[model samples]
Target: MEVDTLRLGFIGFGEAASRFAQDLSQAGLRHIVAYSPSAAKAVLDDAIRKKADDAGVELLKTPKAVCERAQLIVALPPGSKALAVLRRVRPHLRPHHVYIDASTSSVKDMEQAAHMLDGVAPFVDAAVMDPVPINGIKVLTVASGSHAEQFRAALEPYGMNIQVVGEKPGAASAMKLLRSVCMKGLAALLFESLEAAQRYGIADVLAADMARFINGRPFEQIMKRFVCGTAIHSERRIHEVSESLALLKSLGASTRMTRAIRETLQQITDMGLREHFGAREPETIAPVLDAIIDAKRAQRT
Candidate 1:
């Protein structure tokens, strides 16, 4: 379908959906419909209603109404409500309809959604990788499922960056969850460190040092040095983390991340990483990871 002639529907009208609706409308998608439960209450002052109005989106009373009016349906509800939303809209689904679930749900939930939509409509498990309020439809979205490419083909013409990463359902969600482990953990660690630094009147100095260290070298080299060094020096790191935790405590800053660092280093030291490496840092991170995995498996047994 041509961009101007394509009809799009959203199951929710939150920040992400609002941005998408407005952008897609500006991109020549003339028919945009949405069904946000909150849009029905006190229409004059409702934030969702105002968003829909600003986006030129036709706010419908129900999900079924959205499905009936548009063939390309995008679900943008919370992760926990993904399945419930699917179940509510399932009866209105048609084989020709393309259903895109863009919620930050689990792999299992995405797979279950695919199963529920099996033979009813083409399901696209889409993981929005960026903040929609900042990028709108230009946000990088990784999609996976049997019909992910089809979804990409449909939306890419209208300026949506939907990359098809796999043919299996939930593959995109898996990537998002795995990425969150690093991204969210890094955010937590930075938060804790910056809080302590701010209390110590060294926030600017610490931020500059972190930027210099991170931007000075290729990330792969940095990661390898840290991973390998951790294997060899986990014992010493535990002491350092304890001291850092004590400093943070003295400054009345949170010590959760510091405590986690100490516990993780303690766990690695207890796993015999120091003895395994024999005072020499491993050349690569693979052996350190393998040793940790082996130790974990041994413990499981």
Candidate 2:
């Protein structure tokens, strides 16, 4: 179907979907419809409603109208609510309808969503790879499922960068979650470090150290130092983390994260990590993490 004349529908017109629709409007794709599920209408502020109206997007009253009217549908429901939204629209879905779910959700959830529409409509698992608008509506997407290629073709003309990862429904979701774990963990670690440093009047020092660690030293070199050096420095690191926590406590800052870091080092030290790694610095973390796993298994036994 030619995108310019197609009646594209959005199941949830949240930030990302709204941006995509606005981009569609800018690109002269006129026939766009959206249903802000009544359940979600309460949370959507006036600005979002204004944007939708300004974009000339026909805001429908029910999910059924979106499902029955549009040939192509993009589901952008909240991660937790995606399943229920899908179930609501399931009765309205037809074989001609193509549904691409762009919700931030688990692999299991996406797979089950695909199962829900198994023979009814084409389902594409679409994982939005970047923050929308910051990347624009052209944000990269990793998609998977039997209809992934079709989904890619349908959206690519409108400035979307959709890379089809696999023919299985869960692959895109898995890729998204794998990246999330590492990226969000690093973000949390930095937030904790910066918050404590700010409280202790060492924000500049922490920021400078971070820049040096990221730009001056290669990331692999830093990883090797931290993972292997844990054998030697976990005790020193624990001491350092404790001192940092103490300072944060004195400054009336939250010590939860600082204490967690100390506990991690404490675990490494109590497990006799140094003995497990020996005198030489290892290039890999497999053995180091395995040693901890072995210790945990022994405890369980």
Candidate 3:
């Protein structure tokens, strides 16, 4: 399939959605439309109008309207809100249309979504493997589903590092979920350990040691991979961590670390770091960690 002619619709015109649409537009694939529930009609309409005027694309009014205009729909809404959006647009889905979920949702949610859209439209679980802000055109995508092959063919023209994981509806999301177990868990561990060091009045020394411990393979590097890697690509890292916890439980392994990681991510989310750090590189988190250490030290003093 020629990407140049493919009509793409995006639900959730936040940073990731906008970035994807902008990237595609720059690539000369102009048949794109986007809708954002957060953007007021006047605001969204104006932004869409500017994009349309600048790039020659349409900005539709509703999610269903966008669905109606494109053969491929990329759902990039928040993890918690993804299912509701899916339910809303499910009825408008057509047999020829391919729905790609780029959100961070549970394996169960992905499976349910697949079941709901079964026989109506092909559903693909596509996890964004990197942050679109950092990776830009080189974004890596892990996709799985019965229709993954078709979806890959359609997305090729946009120039992506897309990998097809399997023919299962939730395989891609599972892969991402498992990875979050290690990645996000490490971030939380780093935060806790560093804070403890500050409590001991050895923060500087520990930070230096941490630099060496992670040296060529530092925490920042790994985090960069996760933040710039998965966060921007998929909106579902939190739910993915939950799925990883389930995997650990099935294996009869303790979920202490997973649970701690989930809590820390929740902290980050609650602090609104998701918006600030979602598309930032790993290095961007260093200051946040430093501030955390400082606050802990002040409390101790």
Q: Candidate 3, residues 181-204: lDDT per residue as tens digits?
A: 887976776665555556557779
TM-score of 1: 0.82
Which stretches of model 3 miss by more than 4 angstroms? 38-40, 43-48, 51-56, 216-301
lDDT for position 248 in model 1: 96
Q: What local lDDT score does residue 93 receive in model 2, on the 0 to 100 scale?
A: 94
Q: Give lDDT tens digits, candidate 1, residues 26-46.
A: 877778998888874536777
Q: lDDT by residue for model 2 over 1-301, one digit each (tens)?
A: 6666577899998788888898878877777889885533634566766788777687788989887779889999898998998999999999999888889889999999999999999998989999997976778889999989987877778777899999999899899999887788788878877887887788999899889868987887877788889866788788777788878787787777677778889988888877766756667877877888998888789
Best by TM-score: 1
The lDDT of model 1 is 0.90
Per-candidate alpha-carbon RMSD to the true structure: 3.4, 4.9, 15.7
- Clash number for model 1? 0
Q: Which wins on TM-score, candidate 1 or candidate 3? A: 1
The global Cα lDDT (0 to 1) of model 3 is: 0.75
